[model samples]
Target: MNGLDEAVAASGSDVISASAGSLRERFEAAFMPNYGVPPLVPVRGEGCHVWDADGRRYLDLIAGIAVSSLGHGHPALVEAVSRQVATLAHTSNLFVNEPEVLLAERLLGLLKAPGRVFLANSGTEANECALKLAIKHGTATGRTYFVAAENGFHGRTLGALSLTGKPSIRDQFGPFPLDVRFVPYGDADALRQAVTEDCAAVFLEPTQGEAGVVPPPAGYFAAAREICDATGALLVLDEIQSAIGRTGHWFAHQHDGITPDVLTLAKGLGGGMPIGACVGFGESGTIFAKGDHGSTFGGNPVSSAAALAVLDTIERDGLLENVRTVGARLAAAVDAVDHPLLARVRGRGLWLAAVLTTDAAAAVQAEAQRAGFLVNAVQPDAVRIAPPLVITAEQADSFVAALPGILTEASA
Candidate 1:
């Protein structure tokens, strides 16, 4: 057997089989049980600390897969949601709510986009909105076809799924929407060849967040912009996992200095609350008219208020600067770990990961958890680190201090 497979098998034996039995049993009984047995049954969280059902506390580094930007149950979020619920919670799209309008304005002011916002409840829903907008643009301009990158992940909805290049997600979910093409990510020539005048849009992820936090090389995004402009295809960036200060910037794509025709956001926007949006830019802004696309609970007052609180706290608390400092220190620490088990470190800001020598990512994840820290094995050989933006230097130090021991345990 391969070295990675053998290590993975060895690591699996060390997992505490009934570590979270109470919550696991409850989950199996209550939920549809679709997820592959949850990692931990977290009961509460504060700052970067999470307590599981058995009262085990671990320093959180995953940040709910880059969703919980401010960390769990921040006072601002709690107050915002509480106040919003006590005031006005849910009003249909037929009516304009104050928080929704305010959130739209706030988000647009920060984003490089020009057009209006269509809010949704999740990243997938946000991508669905972008797809609808793309369809509207295509129909009006007599264009079809979409170009997406290999290893790209947009969302799970049929249309968004069609744009996603992962065969594991698409192979079973046919027959999908047609006219979608795939090309190697970060390859300007591949993108240029894939996009044509007939294509409606080209979807991309700034850093390919789920693809092991893979950042494109220099000029890749610029090249994409050039191709999209040359072919009359709108450029759409899926910032669902890389936006909302997760990467020490409003969006990871900002580092590339290129703006997209449309952008989808969700993961960290609401700071643990469910909210998403599809924002259009330039001529692509005015594509949506009335009744073209809408969502019921998309911009519900509570969620919008939660987003407002998150934005307020990020600005007032200066968490972005904190993320920059802590992320750099942590990245450097990982690089200096000097373990044969790790290949290298990748990503920018706080969205980083350690590529492994062997495909023992899951083993490493378990070992880290046992070592009183939490991380994610997003890819077989990569462990993604997307800690809360509020993570402090001390917390970053704690994680780094534990890495060698965790790596040793994982490798064993």
Candidate 2:
């Protein structure tokens, strides 16, 4: 049997037993249907690999939807979390903690811009905070409307969902906050027309992650910055999936040589622990007055320490350079394959997607899982590949080498 066949055969029994049900039963009984039913119940993970309940190993490329920056079980992350947990876990927003202050400082330093940060527990919360800040900042001038880009995803909270451009998800969740307009992404002219003096903010992603890693044209952000400046609107860039070294930079917008008035970050910020931040620059940073907004569990000691460790480890181990080098290597290798089924590669650094010629992304994802790899079919024709930063070039090449067979099986 070929490698793919052997892989499937070897895991067949485990798959059958898992489907017959123990974990799935327990999961279905307790969990909400929001995530649907997960196919694999992972027992443990280390480095770039995770093992299912049946003890079958799969190369984890999705990295918890781009949350696991240091991969699974890095010593630094574990040590930091454990130490902070033992010392103090939650202090709430009523009190300040060292880790929280330090993390905020470090983030601002990385941005190299004068800013203040509001911490939160998730990306949605961060975006919500940014939205609130934008509105509050605009209240002085009677600005009300918020402009976002089509196909851009900010988050799923009511406010953030209002800013999201995907109608399929947002349509069902509305009576969302009104006065949100969307222009086609990467169209500077559309944005210029959309952002009037009445606009409160214009939110965008450096690259649309949930829209299957669609990167905007070069200078798109720069032009948006100019438009927002001319219109006196805050430029809020949602870096939830594109920040924290995902694109070989502290923030993806930094690559465009532009600074946004507001920036939101979450995924990969705490390595795996949930944490998010809404950072506002210059006068925008000071818009949130007392009692403006707060989070009960935001910037908890444990999550803050974990985030600090993630930052320290990334700097100490030079993972940023690794991401740039290995990411380029992987992208080049995949493009060089020139498979008939493959359309093109999109995204930068470790965050990437392989566009397929056919609407077989879901099948390709399933085939990849069967072949002992984990990936995400973000769209009908796009397979998102965002492995942990710890993933080596060799590991990436392994996935690239398997693409042709995986696509062939998916087509069948």
Candidate 3:
């Protein structure tokens, strides 16, 4: 047998038969230490729950950090992925594909504007494309600086990280190539002061997802739009975590009744299938000419198909209406839970954070796992809950019923 064949033969059986402990041990030995070993080995999933290797079921509240919009094993998502992969999975930018074009059209339609889209494989990649677009626009306009919101997360790639406002993660990568200025989030005055005539773009999230689900003040985006318009800066909204009906809107910026020059989207766009889009409205859309930038798998049929499925499902199932009513109910219920450890809930629609009275988010997360619930410790003092868009009122009620007890146990 060939070398590759022999290697696969040697390890395939072991991998198939390994239990959770054994799998984790192998993972520690074989994989890079970047993420460390994950706590649970999820073997299967259905609806809003996942079964670990030990067959323990847990109600998934975070939905893969807000990626799985339709939840686990969604038939629409599954069928779209299966059909696309089987038909035409990978077509390089050398040729155009139907799903990619349709997705771009659909995204622009949702935005209620004319635009061009550049598809990528993740949020960072989408932001990277935006960065290049901004740079190109800068080069043409003789702009030198960029402005972004403090505590806002754009992405992890070097250029995108430069735009990100979190110091803890951005500082280590140190001295980024771009000249990006940071202003306090939701502070339109500071944003106006920072985004001068020479600024190329202004990057901001409608709601800061990584900063424990913090939404901007009322009319924040309108002020930003005005600032960018007067200063000739491109307003780039990174809706990586808030788009695709997460906040009861196609794009979170829609709530503000303003549109961004450039909008970056991912996460829920693909329903866990890994797709991102960098859409530019009007002139910004056509900034990247013939050979400015490209990704080998950027607009591949499979990912595009998956994205279309997510969009279609969201529309067909009336998930936006569901998000508005159910999300409000869920937030009210969680807020009403009388507990000393709980402070308040932040964010809009299904994206929420249970602020704590103390730094017990980690303990609460752990306790929640033991109680058959999965939540995210987005911060030391915040527990993030961004469940699937398809999560029913009944499923959310289950978590609400168990939360007080979970908090009590965590306090101990």
Candidate 4:
């Protein structure tokens, strides 16, 4: 038997093939319908491109929702994961691990702030950790309310969802445990009004990723810092989709010249491996004493090694500068498309969204896929482009050049 057949037989499963229909059918049967049915079944990837089960190749612009920082099959990530797994694959919080400690130290060093790190498996978990810490701090200070921005997204878990401002998903979840106040995103005055002494924490995304890569207005974050300081509220910046060179800086809040008391990171940190971190600064860091929180697979060696490799590669390749230069070029080229369907572009660095004149972003996304490129319709009128940080000038230009035609096809 061949390798595929051997694996299937060993698992005692029915035969499977690389055909898209078969794989998708199996996927639906074996998995929950939360994400619905995926449009394409990608079988292989390399650099900035991925091949579907049917053997069609396309430029991967979304990069797994901005998680694949160094793109697919990066040698450094592969080597590190392989070496670490071979040496030591996992060590629960019961024992110490080198990669986990190093990863925490490296992240704190990048922030240039004193803090303690809580490792987790996903962005939602990271936010959950932040939420717990905030609540502990608030409870100690006799605060009961939390503040977030409308149209902002944190995560879907109970604690994180409580801070999420998107009504569509949050409302269905019903009354959350935390009392949260919603404010208009990018409105400093509104934020100031919402965040008072009663507020325990203010959760904000430096750039709203799910709201179509929307960036806050200039001076907004700086004003937020002042407000939080005045109110004695903790500022929590969720950079799950914007950190690790997805933006031009190490962290998106840095662009606004402000530092959040608590920060959450994931997505791009592990370069496709599952990992997340919640960092609490100053007194907030001390709220969680021993036995306050823990995780089993949170900081396993494989994922920590992968995160380290991603960080190392980002610095070694100068991907931060690359993101700035190429992102500017892509934004300008997208705006210069001269297509009537094109409205404008939003976001900074590699995280960008093309806002369409009409609510045809889904159609445009489909057309881009047909034309050998992958993009995300983050909203009815916004197509998101968050390619690998290593995407080149030519690669970005190719997408821009094809966008006009794609928009025309989508409009038709």
Candidate 5:
């Protein structure tokens, strides 16, 4: 069977909108208009394909901002979530739950690092948890100032926002929570100078997923680790957008062999079920200290089960290997393009981004959508490409073949 057919069979039966225009109009009228009108009101999706209200199909490349690891309706996710919700949707943090314990165990084992886990509802929650851990670590030592890399994004919450380095996101939200120092990313000397004993943690992103999918220079993560070590500060790596096979590794830091003391993960962890986790290693791993930190919906049975399913699928389907192969092809395909707007392509595994010379990310995204393809302007001159790990080589080729024309049209 073809990829689309296989995907639908695995997920719930196909679901398409009755009328995209009607749905869009209705959504415009009802929604709070916070996100400024979604590109389209997607009613149904299977694997890497989403059908609009008008029965038009488009190849998905963003993968719900790297949240849909197994794609829209994989059998594993559907079955796991269905079974989990039926059995137990949520049990407050007051009691110990089996699925939550099991999922934490699974994560600890996969991490191959000694640590404790704090679960939450989203990447931002995970970041908030990590920040809490760092704060506690600092409180115990009588220090709390933090160091975050420039262009780095942690979460939107006040605590996590204290560690975020994005100017625009933080501009209106401040004055921020507490002491946070922003240093130039990939600059080891800057980091060394910035991090002090008073610093609770050093927060960074292995690959800046929201910063136009920017990958740090070689040895940057290692240097950050060393700086954190020297300063006795916990290193927090925000892998929300890069973790769980998005970069063909359990965590993107694995590529650099540099594991952070605290790693914040979400996005694809529950395969779009809205789950977040903060895994701390050794001392950093055990700093929660009872009532100092907790979450009501974190580590709920159903979400934990769904995360387990996503992990199982990643292993069973050998999606990481697929990522290595197909991702290389996608990079080459995008690089082969001949266009003035096209500058370069960068990223790892299924999480690729096409860099353009002009700041026409929005126009290119629109053109791609019009051409029956899906992409996003994750940054001013970059369109992030993070398709589902289950995406076939043929699908990658299809996007590549259509990209040049899309670029040409957009540049025109």
Candidate 6:
């Protein structure tokens, strides 16, 4: 036998066996190395819990990087996707579908504003659509420059990656589309200085999710709106990670009582199905004419149906209110622990981060995994926690209770 076959035969009985090391070896041999080595092989999931290939269950706090809004294996999601796929799966963009129309209307109603929606298959595609709209909107006025905030993450596509401020991810991919300037996040004064009549759009996030859930300063969005209005630049909010009840609201910007000219959404929008939206408000909605943009699998019936089910379940089950209450309890519990290794807790609703006093977040994450929990060390000193919106106060408290021990062990 060849070396690879010999190794496989020596390692296990079957390829799908519950050995993470063997699975990881096979994965590395087969897939590209972009994601590096995955630490766990999750075989099944339900609600706020997931079971690994080894049959080890973990309290899933990250929830697929805040994408699993209704959590895993939700019956509503299953039913909607199953029903839609069985009925009519794909008609491309040539013909419209009921689920697509219904989802668009529902999204607009939730925004409580008049707008037009362009559906896509992911957050990056949604941002690409929004950027195209912004550029087109500026065409009538000769505005071509775009502004975004440093430390803000939009997406990884060429257009969206240009708007992202992290140099580590961006520096390697240039020469990108030009004329994009980045200002400090939460610094309205800097944003005011940067925006001008020549600027086409200013992209930002209500809270910097990938930047360890850092929230903006108070009244920052209000100030940003005023500045954009004065400068005649479109204000676009990237709500991909913070929207769809992840932040205890339909959209995180609602907390600031400001309406952006354009909004991009994805992540938890479809519970687990891939879907995204670029919504334009008022005059901004009319910027796109025919042939400006299009996507083949943009708003397919199955994904739209899944999104509809997620929205319905969130409302029917009162998951938004649950997020608010349980999120507060979780944050407060972290504060109550007051561990010496913990610096502070940042973020809102179920989306939170335990900022560490030392750069031991990776160790803490490893320790937490060993303790039967899943958390993300988003930075050297920050561990992000975004449980499913349906997570209970009791479940949150369980994590909170385990955190002190986890931190203690990590520190040691």
TM per candidate comes to 0.94, 0.94, 0.96, 0.96, 0.95, 0.95
* Candidate achieving higher lDDT, 1 or 2: 2
**Model 5, C-alpha of 9: deviation from truth (Å):** 17
Write down the worst ten-residue block by lDDT for model 4. 8-17
List the candidate 3 regions with Cα displacement exceeding 4 Å: 1-17
What C-alpha lDDT does candidate 4 achieve relative to the native structure? Answer: 0.92
Ten-residue region with minimum lDDT total, candidate 5: 12-21
- For model 4, state the Cα shift of residue 91 in Å: 1.0
Deviating ranges (above 4 Å) for candidate 5: 1-18
* Model with the higher TM-score, candidate 1 or 3: 3
Clashing pairs counted in every model: 0, 0, 0, 0, 1, 0
Better of 1 and 6 by TM-score: 6
Comparison by lDDT, 2 against 5, better one: 2
Positional deviation of 91 in candidate 6, in angstroms?
Answer: 1.3
All candidates: CA RMSD (Å):
7.8, 5.1, 4.4, 2.7, 3.0, 5.0
Q: Which regions of candidate 2 are displaced past 4 Å?
A: 1-20
What is the alpha-carbon lDDT of model 3 when measured against the actual structure? 0.92
User: Per-residue error at 299 for model 5, in Å?
Assistant: 0.9
Give me the runs in candidate 1 sitting further than 4 Å from their true place.
1-19
For residues 1-412, write the lDDT of model 3, one tens digit per residue: 6543365467766544468898999899999998889887876678899887677899999999999999988989989999999999898999999999999999989999988999999999999999999999999999999998888998888989999999999999989888989999998889888988999999999999999999999989999999999989999999999999999998899999998999999999998888889999999999988999999999989999999999999999999999998899999999999999999998899999999999999999999999999999999999999999999999999999999999999999
Question: Clashing residue pairs, candidate 3?
Answer: none
Q: Which ten residues in a row have the lowest lDDT in candidate 3?
A: 1-10
